[model samples]
Target: MLLTQYLFQADKPLKTTIRNYTEADFNELIDIQKECFPPPFPSDLWWSEDQLGSHIRHFPQGAICAEINGEIAGSITTLIITYKGQDHTWEEITDNGSIVTHDPHGNALYVVDISVRPKYRKTGLGKLLMQSLYHLVVELKLESVLGGSRMPGYERVKDKLTPEHYVESILNGERKDPVVTFLMKAGRTPVKLLPDYLDDPESANYGLLMEWKNPFFEKTK
Candidate 1:
């Protein structure tokens, strides 16, 4: 089944709440990353305390968490940047995850990371977190929300297909990638295929550039 179908399957409503992640949530964020991106995903790539601090300090509005029954189930971290609207690497754009480059006056919201604990994956926590980010884009009047999504399914076919072809297959409905498909259903459009975007062997170091334009974005004079 496609991710869209799976993610939307009938289920009981969750007692969930989405709110900005605070310094108090730092340790939980670390645990979530481990559950979401275990080994083969380099431990170094996980968010550091310094990086989390940068997120909360630089642009707290762009960093959010989801709670289910008062337990932190997932989180999304982001920063505001004057997007150059060109091909770029994850480390470069995110300042190696510290986001010290976050510009409060920038016009775009860049998603640095989003993670949901394994136990809560089916509770729609991911969707809720993304919805919060979408709301942030509109609330800040940014032009768009940008993110690089790993294609964990890519490594399986790396020997048989190039990264570009892999993404094309997903886009054309000839294939299904959990991360890619889920993001598509969440309203993110794939605008580029990025290579060496991260150190995840599962994705073969490939990432998909996902964008969601703010429908309410307006040019200022």
Candidate 2:
């Protein structure tokens, strides 16, 4: 296998900066999410400044955006939800059983969602955005990143309010959906792909659970 690496600065054609999600960033984030996803969660749900509050909102200042030519090219949200890793919502069966864990080191970054504007797809911006998160992940000594995938028609028909084309764009890949690609490049692995994982029981779907590990730890043993 061949590995490729290059020098990169944020001032290229597709430049991006990671910063706090603010009231100003909310509209752009919403637009990007809606553009890239189908059957998008109601804008009202996201309009709130609550950090998934009252719930285990890892709203740990991990949400960020990719600005290309001074515009919002993409946006990403990372939050960790501690679950019974022994079991999952997918069809896969496991015996791990009722295991509970918290941010062992106090700062694991979990990837909730990542999105790229339709026009900016494939310019390697997504990878850059993904790589930026590592600075925080490693700084916090976090364990891994986590998130879910939308089935082709799951979002569209889940609420029966989404347009068919919008759903297809995200599910099937509009301009190379990089969720799977970037995750792999960043040393993350997909542990599951289950059917009907989302709310739409009728929709054929799969969920991807990915992990990003620290290479330093691998060499010590």
Candidate 3:
């Protein structure tokens, strides 16, 4: 199944709240990673307690979560970075998911992961999470938000299309990829193609670099 495919229905309107993740949300986050990304996606890549600890320790505000009826249902992890204006793998920029390199004064908010419990997919919760991050960008006076997006739909078409053409097709509205399309809907624009960005076979080991610029940002002299 494609990532972000909504497969379950809730019995009632979800009472949701978005807030920065706390240390208490750690185990739920691990379960979320498993629900969002199952086997074939390496278990080792799941958010580790140490890495999650680093996020709260180094950049607490960048670690956001969504709660449904007081249950942690989704999360979006990020870090402040002095962007180099060049291509970098997820592992490189995210410091192998440890985010130990978080820069308190960096001008960019780099998203490391966005995981929604499988049941909450397509519930508008993802958009809420993204909007929270955008608000952070404005509040922090950051220039933009950046992240490498997984192209989970690539594997199906890789035999007949190059990654570039596949992505272009999605951008042109000729095709729709669940993950890429969701990110685009969340206001991110594709910037570059990152080869060997991860180990996911579904993405063909490729990631799309995406950005959302803050309109309120003022250039520092």
Please tell me which predicted candidate would have the highest lDDT against the true structure: 3
Candidate maximizing TM-score = 3
lDDT of 2: 0.51
Model 2: per-residue lDDT, tens digit, 1-221? 11123324454443345554555666676677677654655544342334322112334356567665557777666654443453354222211111122233333455555777877766676776677677666655555555444444443345643333333444455522334555666566655554444443334445555566654332223
- Tens-place lDDT per residue, model 3, 1-221, is 00222222454566677888889999999999999879877899889999999999998888888888668889999999998777788888889988988998888999999988877886788877888888899988999999999998888899999999999999999989988999999999999998889877888999998999999998977
Error of 2 at 60 (Å): 4.3
Q: Residues 160-187, candidate 1: write the lDDT tens digits.
A: 9998899989989999998999899888
- Stretches off by above 4 angstroms in model 1 are 1-10
For model 3, what is the error of residue 191's alpha carbon versus the real structure, in angstroms, after optimal superposition? Answer: 0.7
Each candidate: RMSD: 4.5, 9.1, 4.6
Candidate 3 to truth, TM? 0.92
| Candidate 3 C-alpha error for residue 72, in Å | 0.4
What's model 2's lDDT at 113? 57
**Which segments of candidate 3 are over 4 A away from where they belong?**
1-11
